[model samples]
Target: MASGSPLQPTLGELIASLSLQLTTLVKGEVELAKAQVAEKGKSMGLGIGLFVGAGLFGFFAFAVLIATAVLGIATALPAWLSALIVGVALLLFAGLLAFVGKKSLDKAKEVKPEPVANLKQDIEIVKDGFTS
Candidate 1:
C-alpha cells in the first residue's frame, strides 16, 4: 500500500457512502411528501369544517323561512293546522332526500389505499431485484 490523498476513498468506502446518501435522499423525499400531505389535510379539514358550519346555519335559515311561510298561510287557515300540514310535507321531502342520499352513499366507492399499495409494490420489486 502507498500513501494517497486524504480525500481519496476505497471502492467499498465509495459504495457505502453512495448507499448512505441514497438512503438519506429517499428519507428526505418521504418526509417532504408527508409534510405536504399533512398541510393539505389541514387545509382540507378547515374547508370542510367551514362548509359544515355554513350548512348548519343555512339549515336554520331554511327552518325560519319555512316557519314564516306557514305563519303567512295561517292568515287564511287555522294556524295549528297550517303548521301541521307544512311540517308533514317537510318530513316527507326530508325522507325522500335521506333515501336518495343513502343510495348515493351506498353506490360510492371506498377510499383506495393507492399510495400504500404502490409503495409496497415498489419495495417488493426492489427486494426481488436484490434477491436475484
Candidate 2:
C-alpha cells in the first residue's frame, strides 16, 4: 500500500474527530441554553418585582383615598365618630363578601359530575363481565 498523505485520515482518526466535534457542539449548545434561561429568569424576576412595587403603591393610594373619605365625613361630624362609622361600614362590607365567597365555595363543592357516575358504572360493568 502507498504511504498515507498529510491530508488523508484513517477510519479510526475520522471517528475520533467526529466524536470530539460532536461533544464540543453539544457542550456549546448546553452553555447557550443555560445562558438563555438565566437571562429569561432575570427578566421575569424584574417584572415580578415591579409588579410587587406597583401593588404596594396601589395599596398606599387606596389608604389615602380612605383617609380622604374620613376627612370629608369629619367636616359634618365628630372626627372620632366619623372614623368609627367608616370602620364599621368597612367591616360589614367585608363580612358580606366573606359570606358570598363561602356560599360560592359550598356550591362548587356540591357539584357532582355525571361523567364520574358513568365511569363508576363502567367499572362495575367490567367487574361483572370478568366474574361471568
Candidate 3:
C-alpha cells in the first residue's frame, strides 16, 4: 500500500467543487444579511407606523380643541381668562408629548437586531468550517 498513483484532481472537478462551495458561502452570507435587514426594516416600519398613529391622534385632538372654541361654551368666562386656561392646557399637553416621546425613543432604541446577530453567528460557524 505504500506505493500508489498520485492524488490528482482534474481541472473540471476542482472548479466544480470550488464553485459549489463558493455558492454555498455566498448563499449563507445573503441569508444573514437578509435576516438583519429584515429586522431593521421591521423596526423602521413600526417606527413609521407609530409616528403615523400619533399624527392622526393629534389631528383629532386638534380638531376637538377647535370645535370646543367654536362652540362658545367658554364664552361665560372673560376672553383673557379663557385664553390663559387654553394656553396652560397647551403647555401641559406639549410637556406630556415630550415626556412620552422620550420614553418611546428609549424603548425603541433598546430593540436589538437579534435575528441578524444569530444568523450571522451561524453563518460564521459554517464559513469557518469551510475555510479551515
Candidate 4:
C-alpha cells in the first residue's frame, strides 16, 4: 500500500504534520513557562507578606523590652528622666539602623546588572546566529 492509498501519509503530508506538531510543542512550552512564572510570583508575594508581619511583631517586642529596661532602671533614678534617657538612646539607635538600612537598600537596588548584560548578549547572539 503506497502512501495516500488511504493507509499512510505522503512525504509532504508527513512534513506538514511534523511542522504542526513542532508549532504545538513550542506553544505548549511557552504556556507552561507562563504558568510557572505566575505561580512563583504568587509564592513570593505571600512569603514577603509573612516576612513583613514577622518584622513588625519583632519591632513591637523590642519596644516592650525597652520599656521594661527603662522601668527597671527607674528605681535608681527618677522615672521620667530614665524614660527620657532610654528614649533618646533608642532614637539614636533607630537613626543608625535607618542609615545602614538605606545603604543596604541602595545596594539591593543595583543588584546583578550582569544578568541584564548577559541577556542582551544572548539576544545579540541569537540575532546574529552562529557566525560570530
Candidate 5:
C-alpha cells in the first residue's frame, strides 16, 4: 500500500530470505560431501588395484625363480627321471596352493554396507520440527 526503502525488508520478508539462504547453504554442503566421498572412493579403488598388482607380480616372480631352480636340477639327473620328479613336485605344489587359497577364502568375511552414523541425529531434528 505504501512505498518503502529498497535497502530494507519487512520482518517476514527478511525471515523468508534467511530461510532460503540457509537451505542453499545446506544443499551446497551436501553436494560437497558427496563429491568428497566419491573422490576418496576412487582413491581407495586405486589403492586396492595396486595391492592386487603387487600380489600378482610377486606370484610371477616366485614362479620364475622356481622354474630356474627346477631347470638346474633337471640338468644334473637322467632326463626321464628328472621330468617325472619335476612333474610330481609341480602337481603337489599346485594342490597345496589350492588348499591354502581355499582356506583363506573361507575365512574371509563378505563385504556389506554399514549403517551410517548420525542418522539418529537427523531423525531427532526432523522430530523436533514437528513439535516446533
Candidate 6:
C-alpha cells in the first residue's frame, strides 16, 4: 500500500488527525461566537445613540412648547410676570413628582422578597434542628 493511502492510517495517526480536526472546529466556533457578539454590541450601541439623540430632540421640543406657553400668557400679563408664573408652576409640578416618588420608594423599602424570607426561615429551622 502507498504510504499516503487513506485506508492505511495507524491508530496514533488517526488519533492525531481527530485531535487536530476537533481543535480546528472548536477554534472556528469560538471565532464565530466572538463575531456574533461584536455585531450585536455594535447594533446595541447604535440603538442607544439613536435613543439619546431622540431624547435630546424631545427636550428641545419641550423647551419650545414651554416658550410658546410663556409667550401666549405674555399677551395678557407682563412678560416677566408670565415667565415667573410658568417657572413657579414648573417647580410645583416637580415638587409634587418628587413627593410621590419618595412615597413610592418608602413603600418599596418596607417590602421583602418571598424567596429571601423563605431562605431565612429555612436557615432558622436548620439551626433549631441542630440545637435540638
lDDT tens string, model 4, 1-132? 453765777888899999999999999999999999999999999999999999999999988999998998898999999999998998999999999999999999988578888999999989889666
Cα-based lDDT at residue 8, candidate 4: 76
In model 2, the Cα lDDT at residue 11 comes to: 78
- Model 5 scores a C-alpha lDDT of 0.85
lDDT of 1 by residue, 1-132 (tens): 465567898777889999999999999999999999999999999999999999999999998999998999899899999999899999999999999998888777565559988999999999999999
Any residue pairs clashing in model 4, and if so which?
none
lDDT of 6 by residue, 20-59 (tens): 9999999999999999999999999999999999999999
lDDT of 4 at 7: 71
As for lDDT, the candidate ahead, 1 or 6, is 6
- Candidate 2, residues 24-72, lDDT tens digits: the string is 9999999999999999999999999999999999999988988988899
Q: Candidate 5 lDDT, tens digit per residue, 57-78? A: 9999988876776677779977
Which stretches of model 5 miss by more than 4 angstroms?
A: 1-9, 97-132
Q: What local distance difference test score does each model get?
A: 0.93, 0.94, 0.86, 0.93, 0.85, 0.95
Clashes in model 2: which pairs? none
- The better-scoring model by TM-score among 1 and 5 is 1
| Least well predicted 10-residue stretch by lDDT in candidate 2 | 1-10
By TM-score, who's the top model here?
A: 6
Model 3: per-residue Cα lDDT over 1-132, one tens digit each: 444436866677789999999999999999999999999999999999999999999999987886577445367887667767777877899999999999999999999779988999999999999999
Output the lDDT of residue 2, model 6. Answer: 38
User: CA lDDT of 115 in candidate 3?
Assistant: 92
